[model samples]
Target: MYQDEIIQRVNNAAEIENSNEMLIIRKIEESEKPMELMLNENDRISDIKIRKLVDCIVGRKIIAEKVLLIRDHFVSLHDYLDLLNSGCLFDDEYDALFATFGNFEISCIL
Candidate 1:
């Protein structure tokens, strides 16, 4: 069921004209499980899959630009991920993060 949900999200994201948005949605889908578990103090966002996704986004200039624009503040992708993984963000901060990653529309599902 979870896999199906992810696939649906991927398809929806693919409908967007912006390839970066599509990629961001796919990353969010990839990291959804870890992100949910990350709310627990015992779980960490340093999980390999999440890290690799972050790295991929950071490595791509165009995607990184889109991410930075969504951030609305200058910060490297590594820093953004670190802040997110730290689990200390306020509601608005988390919202901004989701918006930056093109996941705002489906954030409730996340």
Candidate 2:
């Protein structure tokens, strides 16, 4: 799926010498497994298809910004994924990342 494409790109970006590329790579690496786990169809809520819903809610820019944040931070991908799953989309450093992609209206109202 698209996450696989993102993983491949992350692996590739990790090999580069540039700082930005490395940052991107780190983000992808951190996110890969957690994102995969969250996307598991069996694990998703009955009313929500996690992956599809996320794709729709986040859009491309937010997704990109999140990856960038993941790249810069040393946290595991699951942590962020959990936060997203739990509806803490604007918590802690995630808020910074969200801000970077411009102000977005989270589809799920708090």
Candidate 3:
């Protein structure tokens, strides 16, 4: 299934879990300014995934748990691709990009 489909499933499930999910969305929206500043500071890339994930989580496009899971497993190439595939990033060609920067380690951020 596509990422959008997966996101819809997650939203539906979250709604089932809490009937007032919209309220949570509204609360999150109210804090958007500071959140954007924090994201800009924390995000190390010009990549859209970081921004999209921020949007998705704030809008509850996907669940917090799923986002956290993706963030946790970002060290793996496969997991990284999965995140990119999920509309979090704009990699038209994953293989080429991976080939070019595969050896770089996230820990070696210097």
Q: Which regions in candidate 2 have their CA more than 4 angstroms from the true location?
A: 1-62, 88-110
Those runs of model 3 whose alpha carbons end farther than 4 Å from true positions after fitting are 1-70, 89-103, 106-110
> Tens digits of per-residue lDDT for model 2 on 1-110?
47678887777766764555333333445323332211223332323444444454355355455556443431333433554575524444465544433212222212
Candidate order, lDDT descending: 1, 2, 3
Candidate lDDT (C-alpha), each: 0.47, 0.43, 0.43
- For residue 103, model 1's alpha carbon misses the true position, in angstroms, by 5.5
Worst 10 residues of 1 by lDDT: 33-42
Write model 3 residue lDDT over 1-110, tens digit each, in one string: 36576678778888678655442322334423321111122334435654565355345433444445444435434445445555643333333333323223332321
Each model's total of backbone clashes: 0, 2, 1
Which of candidates 2 and 3 is the stronger one according to TM-score?
Answer: 3
